[model samples]
Target: MDEKFLRKKSFALPKVNPFIHDLQLSMKDKLQILVMSFTLAPIRLFLIFILLIFAWLIAFISTLGLDIDSKKPVRSWRRLPILLLQPIMRAVFFCMGVIWIEQKGLPASRKEAFIYVIAPHSTFYDAVPCAIIATTVVAKQDLISAPFIGTLLKTLQPVLVVRHDPDSRKKTIQEIHRRASSQNEWPQIIVFPEGTCTNGKALITFKAGAFIPGVPVQPVLIRYPNYLDTFTWTMNGPGGLTLLWYSLCQFYIRFQVEFLPVYTPSDEEIDDPKLYAENVRFLMAQALNVPCTEHTFEDCRLMSQAKSKDLPMEAGLVEFSKLSKKLGIDINEMNEMLDEFALKSRSCKDGLMGIEEFAELLCLPITEPLKELFNLYDRDGSGKLDFREYVIGMSLLSHAAVTEKSIKIAFKVFDRNGDGTVTHDELDHVLKSVFGHDFETRNIYDKIDQENKGRITFDEFYAFVKKRPEYAKLFMTYADLEQDDMPQDKIHNITQRRASHALAGSSILSNVQYSNQGANAILKEKKDE
Candidate 1:
């Protein structure tokens, strides 16, 4: 990669750090907030609390004998108190400075669309929509235990979701499908399909819960048109209390809710809920006048992980949906690779690895071949590797070629001294023995033996082999070429035959006994394959 060319090349996707929002306050804005803090904030706070207490009292009385978790919805005369609670909730929003809400396009009737999908859910301020619609919502299970808020949410008969429970997601989806497909038995359910907050500059990937039922959905767009934004709460932004304090101090907050036309799925979309979700998201994004991104909530988890490991939080925003699709790697695999990247970049800063750190990671010196490999991974040729490039390069170069059997065979081949150690000469000797070729192994031994020992241990040999998976591929290729009758496509055939031939031949591995247990396991794998 040419340094100049790489610097000029544009990335495939625009970089949008949606997990962060840096609120800039001007002198005048600060003065206004300071004045309002003593003037209107206390009165707003008091009135808001009073409204919440009254709403909670009504909700508590109405839901006294109702089964909040019932498979059936509450109906008939029992819903009278729940009906009475809506205006009081609206009153709460009024006291919080959301005096009037601007609406565009009429909301869909329940018979037409039972699911209302909302987006750009940036803060608790989004609760304004729930109060406006007076409908049930999908919420986290923990919210049901909140002091006064619990009873209020229960009155809506929400579909509460539990985190970290294996069956919770499945149940949530099934419940959504049930409610959406019912015959006017349940109130329309509201879903925030982004599943988390963003800065609202772009639309992130949407979760499929709202579309899984193959039902028509109303897309609702939210906007905070305030001149000075104190409403965005993201992973690295202001906390809820701080944003609330600032919002309460504002003279007025402008909130707009635009309901797009009800979107009914086609046959293809009905068969694939993810596609249904993407189409709806694109429509909403176009209406909101923003671009759609492949970043998902999983990226936020990665950002948190990066912060915990002392890296820049933005380092983990890898456009996860796009990269994962292109690389054919899943989040679990990417997470494991992050730990390895953390180990290599600990001595570096800005969550990037320079040439020195790259060399250290591979247990090699800055030779031409090593630098060539490093440059291959440094996509932008900034002379450094970010976590995204590191993961792509490593998955492409190492994941397929490095396996448990290959590690053992390579370790056994390289440990030529029989004292369970390999010097530089032994590494070269094993390369020649296995591949009938010589490789430049200069300084590899000294680098692997960090304590300055002349020879490297088996663990060191194994680690080196893992980091350089291309060497394992080379060994396997030579073994395959040696036995032309062996099936080249079968991995176990190559590994099994290599171990047998190396042990039986009059060569470096002749005296070494390849484990029978390992051989039997390989045989079993071959049979299973």
Candidate 2:
């Protein structure tokens, strides 16, 4: 699928530059991760069995007298079974230590059918719990495969879909449109618009299918309080049964479902479901206190495949080798900085530091350059440094800050044709992302294309960046730039500036795109301890 079409405009990736919000877990929180890992709870295990038995019975009884096809009002006496059985299920939830939505938290009026959107779905519990008040759920097509549960699943009346299949998507949308338009008999449509489960720490990009019906949506945000984070599904993590057993072991599983004000789309928003969907996602993310990842559900699922092999879904942890390789830095140097970063951190024995700690990293006399490096590489502004961001940010600050090899590697990123040369088209592709202008692209090309052969090889590009003292100085900070050729007086001025620094190296910050904080100015060097 074309990304532009699938993507939501309002789902912005936050920047981690100025704010140093480290995801600090309290001592209690840290202990939760430990307890859940080691302890086995037999009490909750038994409770889950009881709940399952009751759940099956409730499902069958709840749908007994309803004309599912008939357009009946939710308040009708026919839905009495559903209403009565919901509280019984909720009692089972209480026994299982499920903390869910309160009566005061639900929409004041329950008469109207709402197209509900829920987010931060860590497990099936996110949806199953909604039955306490609402009935219908939008599930996936795979539900048909389950033999026994297939019958019980009928109670939810989920709008199951096969992702990425157009026919399935069309059918599901038509179903929703028809039912939403129907006055009676339709259960409120509950959709997990993110289309997959997450760890609840971050909001992934939303799918637009939920908004396609052009109905007002009641956005619900779900949060599972966990330290070890056994709730959300992962690629290599525990399976559903394993997760259920693990949750049973926890001291208690507490989850919250917050129903925000109903979001009625304006005429403009109705026409653009993508905008409406993303805007709703943005609102949910803000309420949940999580950042937005640029990845979609399918994107995260694919990423999880690679992570399944060896990479854990650890927060603020990146592989040292991968980081070194991407930034073209020596692994040893990156490792050294990582060691120092952990030492200076409050609780980084794990070798991970929040982006704020990294911003304040004091290996170099000037921490400004380090912060600038951090701001540049901290793409999502997650306020914390993952392995990749840490490696790139610190590698640039280390000795090979902006050498010929690094510069060449950077250029190759824009060398789309693999021609060992960067043509105007390639430069256009690159500079457009950086400056977002063709005029600047043309200007940058004219300056670097020393041969004027309509393109520039690595050699010409290197020479263009090398002679200027500004290139080296800029390398010491964030956001690199090009300069006009220097006269002898300018060269002499550069010489005087370098002399005044009285250090082994003064000019380091190169013109790679980086975040611009107070540290954007490069002043001194990273002293060798």
Candidate 3:
């Protein structure tokens, strides 16, 4: 899709640029890095490392002999060391040039909200909020194995989650629910609902675990209002060491945290955890003054897939979360479909399908009918179909309309002479039946009649329909009109009317084209006047 067109138009959902971050350095910035490498960077690293060891030692003693997997909170005496460790942890950040943290609004008490949902989780520096609050976090289970950071993270008794394990996700949710319902027995938990870092231009979809318990949650926003951004840790951004070097070189990193009001879920939100999470995310994005996007961690996986397939990494960013919700498809299904898409698009330069590739994939030659179908998928008039467009067309225009029964009925309707074969006249009749007019179909018929016998058997017809499933909807509509024993003229009129309605309902491209044509026609009439 054209980025300019996307920016100029108002879309149902905002455009997402959450996963890319490019760091461009100026001469002054380079000089500062050179200067700080010798001066402040060395001192900061030394002091921060020392403070980290002290903090880790404190955490080690505090967590000693305690069951790391315990569902219950630690005893009161065990919590005392954490209180001491918090100041040391704060000092570590201070040494790293986070001299001060500007906080806004009051944080909710444990009784008011057992969960705090943080957003715009863009960098490792975001740990400042965790340190300031001294709350437990939902961390990766693998973090427990990290050298010094592992001991420190364990000290907070974070809810450890294992990615790629369905049972682990279930247990994490169950554990969150348990804590929320424990009535002050457990410490307040903080969740970065995005589950991954972004470039911070937009807020991505929030995971529902924190909101699942139906308890009150305080939405927190983190911002780094700095002139130079060396903090955002995105998949396309600078490496951790590069960001760390840039960050350490800076005299002080500006950080701010704003706590929104504690949100108590209503009955509706309680029942629908996804709704609760979305509402909370929307509120946070509003506070951050950035758009909320449908992008999620799933896009990261898709981006990786795109890269592996030699397509632009952004090609796989099909706003999978939103498409899944609308189309009722899952990531695994999309992944499988992507493999098919890759095969069809292999001849194309950009990993997208043009009209030629579209025809080749369906085993049909280019014709007006094929062009129409390709146009339906070539949304944005870009003359190509991206993965998102392909998926949408497949879901709404093809799969939903193309079924075994419908295909059989349409094929029978096309075989007028009942000789188990369809000739050119019958193919033309089939097109006229659905389109209400003639479409040059010599190419279409020849493509289907691979044997060059001037006739296509039922197998050929079925194969053609299978390749172009979008036609099934129109074919079935025509078959229905034929079953009613309508006159050809009457069938044509009804088919024309119904075709507009069916395409309007099933194809987004249809709406875009119709709206554009309608506006053009209106303008032409005005000029005539």
Task: Say which candidate scores most in TM-score.
Answer: 1
What lDDT does model 3 reach?
0.78
lDDT of 2 by residue, 1-529 (tens): 1122112233222442111113345677657646755644565556656776776676666656644333344455535555655665666565555754433256523344368788776676675445566657776677745754654556656677887677999888888887788766666777887676656667666778878878888887776655555455644356776666555555666676677888888898789998888788898889877776544444343234323333333322333223333455443454444445445453654434565565344222223334444555454566565554454443443333356654565556557677898888876754343322422456556767766898688788777555333233333221122122234343333333332331122233333322243123222221110
After superposition, the stretches of candidate 2 with alpha carbons farther than 4 Å from their true spots are 1-40, 58-84, 99-104, 108-113, 225-228, 304-529
Per-model TM-score on C-alpha atoms: 0.80, 0.51, 0.78
- Kindly give the stretch of ten consecutive residues in candidate 2 with the minimal lDDT sum: 520-529
Model 1: how far is 335 from its true place, Å?
Answer: 2.2
Residue 97's lDDT within candidate 3 is: 73
- Which has the better TM-score: candidate 1, or candidate 2? 1
CA error at residue 284 for candidate 3, angstroms:
1.9
Candidate 3 Cα deviation (angstroms), residue 208: 1.5
Q: How close is candidate 1 to the true structure, as a TM-score?
A: 0.80
lDDT of each structure? 0.75, 0.54, 0.78
Residue-wise C-alpha lDDT for candidate 1, range 68-149, written one tens digit per residue: 7898888877689888887887898898889899989888989888999999888877888777776799988999899877
Pairs that collide in candidate 1 are: none
Extract clashing residue pairs from model 3: none
Between candidates 1 and 3, name the one with more favorable TM-score: 1
Error of 3 at 418 (Å): 11
